[model samples]
Target: MNNELIEKGYRRYVGNKIDVYFNTNICQHSGNCVRGNHAIFNLSRKPWIVPDNATLEEVKRVIDTCPSGALQYQEK
Candidate 1:
């Protein structure tokens, strides 16, 4: 687990090959995340972020688009 991200108020979403972190406090709701991959970041779903729902590259690519730095990830 990323202690720094957790300390910064980002919730962790663990996956088999990757981990996603989201800080709602810092999120600007740019829609980049949901738009990038609904299967991975669908708000209608419980525990919205499912890293394994998308490919690792896709996950990283989308996370990079977070303008607010609300999204972060670590490759397992």
Candidate 2:
């Protein structure tokens, strides 16, 4: 687990090759994540950020679009 991210209030979503982190308090509701990949960022899902649902490149691409810096990732 990413203790640094956790300390910053970012929740971790574990995956095989990469791990996603989300800080809801920092989110700007930009919708980029969901629009970029529904399978990975489905809001209706309980644990919405499923890093394993998409490729590392795809996840990184979408997260890069986050204007608020609320989304981040770390490769394993």
Candidate 3:
């Protein structure tokens, strides 16, 4: 988990290869994260962001579409 992101109100979702971070307040609700990869960003899931569900490249690719900068990833 990222101390800076958490301190900034971003929640952490732990994964095997990477960790996903999200700040709901910063999200624009653009649906880019979910649309990019449902397996990783399913809203129905207990944890909306599942980094291990997809490849690191895939996760990064989708996060790039987040105009709000709400979603972030860090390498393990």
C-alpha lDDT of all candidate models, in order? 0.95, 0.94, 0.92
Lowest summed lDDT window (length 10), candidate 1: 67-76
- Name model 2 segments beyond 4 Å from true: none
lDDT of 2 by residue, 1-76 (tens): 8899899999999989999999999999989999999999999998998999989999999999999989989999
RMSD of candidate 2 to true structure, Å: 0.7
Candidate 2 has an lDDT of: 0.94
Local error of candidate 1 at residue 8 (angstroms):
0.8
Candidate 1 TM-score versus the reference: 0.97
Higher-ranked by lDDT: 2 or 3? 2
The runs of at least 3 residues in candidate 1 whose Cα sits more than 4 Å from the true structure, single-residue gaps closed, are none
Which candidate's lDDT is highest? 1
Report the Cα lDDT for candidate 1: 0.95
